[model samples]
Target: MAMLNQVSSQDVETLYFNHHGWLLGWLRRKLDNSFDAADLAHDTFVRVLRKRELEALREPRAYLCAIARDLAVSHWRRQALEQAWLETLATLPEPIVPSLEQRALILETLEQIALILDALPMRVRQIFLLSQIDGLTYPQIAAQLGVSINVVQKAMVRALMQCYKVLYRGG
Candidate 1:
């Protein structure tokens, strides 16, 4: 078992060595910063090693590249979300201003929430935004939508379930 583990480790190391540069280069083409590309490349290898069936990856290079690409897209999305959050913070009232560190924390949380919200269907997302962000009650929302209270409650529950699924998916 020890020998088998050693062989597996060696295989993963070889895979990383052979593909890290190519992955970085691929990421660099899509991203502006070499450091960011390198970071994503390292993350890709980390994810690859954690997989239970790395040996089963027939086209390892392609698989690794795909992982890196997904990471790159996620990075871009997070950055965009953070920027938007910062802008929103800047527009808040002076007494409600957040410190720099607090702003970062809030941005991170909002990004996670945004990701959860994005997974929801369009009407579900609208309902959730209206209820949570706009602070609308079920009866108020129901009246606004011309739906019954029970329908609004059901929509809220569905939206909440979708958010929970996105949050707990271990992405």
Candidate 2:
């Protein structure tokens, strides 16, 4: 995809003039924060403009909503991940905890992991959490989810590959 700055000025202006208000209102309703809604509305347009086929769009609002919904899901995932990270931090012994800068870097890494998790299918994601977060063995996870051991192992491999790509490949 093209960068936001690469989008043509006239095209962006036209799209903003035609859809800005409606999209902002829609995001506001979904986000419940005027600032965040406004920011996401701008980002939605940025993503839309960066697409290669904007001129061919038959229904712009529908497309805009599709992009906005994705952004909303990402926003919520970050929020949930941050909350969980903070809770985990609270449980750590303060003397052994990392410094503030280290904590920030660790949180950024966790955010990437969470995004990878988001891309996974529901069953694969559940299996990953059971194995990683809940510390279950592969056989235990397979039995709990009513799948064969082979299936659980396959899901775990898929999840690990996704995480590896995000962590090492800048995906």
Best by TM-score: 2
Off by over 4 Å in 1: 1-7, 93-95, 121-127, 130-155, 165-171
Span of ten consecutive residues with least summed lDDT in model 2: 1-10
**Candidate 1 residue-wise lDDT at 92:** 90
**Per-residue lDDT of candidate 1, residues 1-171 (tens digit):** 111232266777988888888888888998979999989998988887776554455687888878888888789989998888768878999999988889878878877887777677887888888899999999998889888889888879998887767768754
- Per-candidate local distance difference test: 0.82, 0.86
> TM-score of each candidate?
0.71, 0.82
In the range 45-103, model 2's lDDT, one tens digit per residue, is 88866766555456778878998999998888878877987898899997977889997
Model 2 residue 51 CA deviation (Å) reads: 2.5
**How much is the lDDT of residue 171 in candidate 1?**
41
